[model samples]
Every structure is written in structure tokens, then in C-alpha cells.
Target: MFPLVFLTVIALDQLTKHLVRGGMALGESIPAEGFLRLVHIQNTGAAFGILDDARPWLIAVSSIALVIIIWLAISRRIGFLDNIWGRLTLGFIAGGTLGNLIDRAYYGYVTDFLKAGIWPAFNIADASMVIGMTILVFLYLRSEYPRSQ
Candidate 1:
């Protein structure tokens, strides 16, 4: 399940990035329906374009993150693979990390599209990472600190 979800997210993310790169020009925007549009842009830094000049460090950090995730999975540190939500979390982070990692290694940047309203333009990888992290936090809090009855 973990591998399946990871691969699915990576495949979908890469496919979308490939399509956007091939079909759109950099900085070009094609409006969709309301408050939605397709865009082609690149982010060299962390989320929302932070640390714009730290490509090497960013790559190193991303690589380390992937390693730690893999280590945990293999060693069963978090037992994430055994739980459904945990698997989802792992898959999301792994997939998202791998997706952006590939772009960073190959292009020195990550491709981002899928713009909506005032929010920053982001790709599937970003969405996956955010969703996965959100799930992880929710689960952790639920398990570690039960609500008062």
C-alpha cells in the first residue's frame, strides 16, 4: 500500500509537471473557470519561494529528509506502514519529496503550476506534502493526547 500510494503520487505528479512544462511557457497563465488557472513557473527555494539562493543546501536537506523517511520505513521506527493513515502520510511525504527532488536534481528548480486565487502557485508534490503533513499531525495529536471525556 505504501509503495502503491507513493508510486501513484510520484507518477501523477511527474506526469502533471511534464505536461505543464511541455504545453506552457514560463510565466504563462491560462485561465480556467473561476479563480483557477494553469501556470508555468519554477521555484528554486523552499515553499513560497523562500531561500531563493540556496539551491545546494536545499538539495542536501531534501536528500536527508528522503533518507530519514526511508530509514524509518525500513526500521519500523514509526510503524507508519502498519496504519492506514500512517501509510497515507508516509506515501504523501515520500512521493512529494521524490517528485520535487527529481526536479531539483535535474533542473536546479522545481516546476510549479495549478494556481488558484491569491495563493502561491504550487505543483502536485507540494499539495501531497501538505496533505501528508496535515494527516501526520492530526494522527499524532490524536494518539498522544486523547481528548478529555
Candidate 2:
């Protein structure tokens, strides 16, 4: 399950980026009639283009995160990960991290295309990371909360 989710995330992320790059010119945007838009933009930094000048640092951080997540999943140090959902969450994080890391290594930037009004443009990798982390946090909180009779 972990491998399936991980590979699926990575494959979808890379494939979407590839399609966008091949079909759209850099900085080109197709505005939707509503809230969504597709824009070809390269982000040189982490989320929302922060640390634009620190590509190497970002790569290092991403690599470290990937390692830690992989370790946690394999080590079974966290009890929650004994469940399928927990493993899937970790897979999402690992796959997303790898997806962005690949882009930073090969292109010196992450290719972002999906855009919604007022939100910073983001790619599939970013979406996966956010979703995975959100679920992990929920799991943690749920475990820590005191259940009443």
C-alpha cells in the first residue's frame, strides 16, 4: 500500500509537470472562467516561492525530510503507522518530497501550474505534501486526545 501510494504520487506529479512544460510556455497562463487557472511558473524555492535564493539549502532540507520519513515508516517507531492510513500518509509525504527534489536537482526549480485565486501557484507534489501532512497531524492529535466515557 505504501509503495503503491508513493509511486502513484510521484508518477502523477512528474507526469503532470511534464505535460505542462511540454504544452505551455513559461509564464503563460490560461485563466478559467471561474477560480481555477493553469499557469506555467517555476518556483526556485520551497512553498510559495520562499527562499528563492537557496536552492541548494532547499534540496538538502528536502533530502533530509525524505530520509526521516522513510526511516520512520521502516522503523515502525510510530505506532500510528501500523495502520494502512498512516503508511499511506507517509507514502504521500515521501513521494511528494522526492518529486520536488527531483525537479530542484534537474531543473533548479519546481514546475508549478495549478493556480487558484489569490493562492500561490502550486504543483501536484505540493498538493500531495499538504494533504499527507494534514492527515498525519490529524492522526497525531486524535491519538493524543483523551477519550471520554
Candidate 3:
């Protein structure tokens, strides 16, 4: 189940990136109207444009984190992946992490194309990461307060 979800998300992320790479030039912006656009950019660091030029350290840290997350998930030590919410969250995180890791490993940067006026330009991987984190937070809150007990 984990592999299936991870592969699916990774494939989707790669496919979107392929499309963007093939169709858009660097620094090109395809307006989507309002506040949305497809803008080609490469990030060599973490979320929201942090550490933008630290490729080696970023890749090493990300690789190690990915391995740890996979190990925990497979060992069932991650608790969260034991339930539906947990499984989905794990899948999203795994896929997103791997998606960006692939870019870091191969191109020394992560391809980011999706853009919004008030938000940073990011990719499908970023969206997955955000969703996974959000789910984890929700789960934590729920666990802290059991329903109708």
C-alpha cells in the first residue's frame, strides 16, 4: 500500500515536472489569471525559498530524512501510517520528499513551477508536503482530544 501510493504520487509529480520542463522555458510565466500562474523555477534549498544555494547539504539532509521516514514507516514505528489518515500522510510525505530528492540528486535543484501571487512558486511535491503536514497536525489534534469519550 505504501509503495503503491508512493509510486503513484511520485509518478504524478514527475509527469507534471516533465510537462513543465518540456513546455516552459526558465523564468517563463504562463498566466493562469487572478493570482495563479505556471512559472518555471528551480530551488536548491528548502521550503519558501530558504537556503536557496545550498545544494549539497540540502540533498544530503533530505536523503537522510527520506531514509529515516521510510525506515519508520516500514517498521510501523511511525504510528501515523497505521490508520487511513496516517497512511495517506505517509504516502504524501514519501512521494513529495522523493520527488524533490530526485531533482536534487539529478539536477542539483528542485523544479518548481506552480505560482501564486501571495505564495512562493512551488511544485506538486510542495503541495503534497504541505498536505501531509496538515494531515499530521489534524491527527495530532484529534488524538489529543478523543471524540465523544
Each prediction's RMSD to truth: 2.8, 2.5, 2.9
Query: Model 1: per-residue lDDT, tens digit, 55-121?
Result: 8898899899988876665565664244777777888998999999999989989999988888889
Expressed as tens digits, the lDDT of each residue in 78-149 for candidate 3 is: 454577777778788889999998988888888999988889899988898889889878886667344534
- TM values, all candidates: 0.90, 0.93, 0.89
Cα-lDDT of candidate 1: 0.86
- The TM-score between candidate 1 and the true structure equals 0.90
Q: Which model scores highest in lDDT?
A: 2
- Location of the lowest summed lDDT over 10 successive residues in candidate 3: 140-149
The residue-level lDDT of candidate 3 at 130 comes to 88
Query: What is the lDDT for 8 in model 1?
Result: 91
Residue 142, model 1: lDDT of 70
Stretches of candidate 1 off by over 4 Å are: 32-34, 79-81, 145-149
lDDT of 3: 0.83
- Each prediction's Cα lDDT score? 0.86, 0.90, 0.83
What local lDDT score does residue 121 receive in model 3, on the 0 to 100 scale? 91
Index of the highest-TM-score prediction: 2
Ranking by lDDT: 2, 1, 3
| Candidate 2, superposed: residue stretches over 4 Å from native | 32-34, 144-149
Candidate 2 has which clashing residue pairs, if any?
Answer: none
